[model samples]
Target chain A: MKTGIVVFPGTWSDRDCAHALLEVLGEPVRFVDYRERDLGDLNLVILPGGFSYGDYLRCGAIARFTPVMNAVADFANRGGLVLGICNGFQILQEARLLPGALLRNASCEFRCEWVQLRVEQSDCAFTVDCRPGQVLRIPISHGEGNFFADPHTLESLEANGQIVFRYCTADGRITPEANPNGSLRNIAGVANARGNVLGLMPHPERACEPLLGGDDGLAIFRSAIHALNRVAV
Target chain B: MTYRAEVFVTLKPVVNDPAGLTIRGGLHALGFESVKDVRAGKYLSILLDEADEDQARSRVEEMARQLLANEVIEDFRIELQPEPALAESRGGGPS
Candidate 1:
């Protein structure tokens, strides 16, 4: 399966994503510029972590208007797998490909630390490799990662099993203290209702190597590859 | 006609405003104990050409809805004013 890693002007994590996908996982991947209007045939598209467009006028707000986003939106509508990490998640929400908005952390500080994530839904494309309630150690580096949604939307997400991951303790217990950001319901990641688009704040690419702290994030990518291979066969 | 739109965007009442809260805390530290709450937001000034005041208002509203404000967690208000002097100064130059 092939993957496309989108690179915006201020994006800093594209190379990390490429390293994880190409050098670490041995998957074919390419860098897609934000100015490009077409996304070539690819099984997965990744919006890596970074301050796209300098994170001005709200994180991912301006970046959503880039030419590449139109193609990404169309690709998602056609059921192509899209994984948005950090700012990518914000961009997806801003583009309305996903629900809710990311607000500033309650502490009003930029937090960069390893946090535990409890996999809430294993049936989705992004977490198919993770067992239900599995805990993964992934680091989140951002100031605006507080996820917020209205009551009705939150209920729908829960009912539809769209919540893929939540902040939790090392032992896989969900608690307020475990939540690095003040995300509602400790939501660290979510998928669209169709399950094809996944957006999360954690840097999975940054955690794919054992030398980089851990490899638990590899499951997220491996899961996407697994899902893509299933459809190809 | 040229119109200037001053748009104010703020978080919804239910959404937590961390920046606002921090500001309130700072106020308390400054001995303003009676400060109940504070809500921070963004202000934008946009200049556009339209046929009439109604058209200008509608266009700026559309702009706020489409880009300036995210309805999911924020609300926006726009104030429109005609800029006749600026329009005259342009003297029918390129928009």
Candidate 2:
């Protein structure tokens, strides 16, 4: 599968993301400069983590206006698959591609650590390889990863099975203390209503290399590849 | 014409404001006991060279909606008037 990774001016994870897909998953990867307007031919797009636009004015405020985001929004509107990691998630929220917003961590400090998140739904392409309640460790580093949505929106997300992942204990039970960034309902990731676009603050690419200690993130990428293959069939 | 644009962008009240909170704490320590709540945001003054007052007001409003503010969380107001014949005031134009 061919994947496109959007690299904004301050994007720091473009290489890691590309390497994860190309070297680890054996998929062709391309770097998508945020200044470029064309998406060309690609099956998936990944907006990797970084302090885009120096995270000024708000985490994702400035980066949302980049030329590439317009194309990314269009692609996702047409049912194209997209993954947003860390600051990318903030960008998605700032763009209104997803509901709610991210606030500073409850402790008002940047958090960097491996968090165990339970797969809430496995039917979507990104998590199809995971079983409900399956635990996977991924790294999260951000100051504005605290997700906030109104109670109504949260309820709708729950009823529609849109809540895809949540921080959980090693045994896969969700708890307040397990919440890494004070995200509402312990949400770690969520997909749009159509399930084509996903925004999460965890850096799955950071865990794709086994030499880095774990390759728990491989399944998410592999699942997307499989989903695309199945659709082609 | 001197176009008056007042830009007010505030975080949604529900969203916590670390900057505001820190400032509040400082104010308390400095003995500003009367201050109850503080929300910090940017105030922009823009000078417009539109043909008429109405056009300038409309243009400033467009800017507020598109760039100056996030419609979801912030609110803004605009005012337009003829420029002062003597001196250029430094506040309330556009941002």
Q: Native-contact fraction for each model?
A: 0.84, 0.11
Query: Which one wins on TM-score?
Result: 1
Residue A168, model 1, lDDT: 100
Per-candidate DockQ values are: 0.82, 0.30
Which residue pairs clash in candidate 1? none
Cα miss at A86, model 2 (Å)? 1.4
Report how far off residue B58 is in candidate 2 (Å): 3.3
- Which lDDT tens digits does candidate 1 get at residues A19-79? 9999999999999999999998888999988999898888999999999999999999999
TM-scores of all candidate predictions against the true structure? 0.97, 0.88
Query: For residues B1-95, what per-residue lDDT tens digits would candidate 1 score against the true structure?
Result: 88898999999999999999999999999999999999999999998999999999999999888888999999999899988788877777555
Q: Which lDDT values do the candidates have, in the order given? A: 0.94, 0.85
How do the residues A1-233 of candidate 2 rate in per-residue lDDT, one tens digit apiece?
Answer: 78999998899999999888988878999999889898988889999999999987678888999999999999999888999898888888888888778877876689999899999999978998888889999888898898888778889999988889899998999999899878989999998888888888888999998787688988789888999998989
Residue B69 shift from truth in candidate 2, angstroms:
2.5
How accurate is chain B of model 2, given as a TM-score from 0 to 1? 0.74
* TM-score for chain B of each model, two decimals: 0.89, 0.74
True contacts kept of 2: 0.11
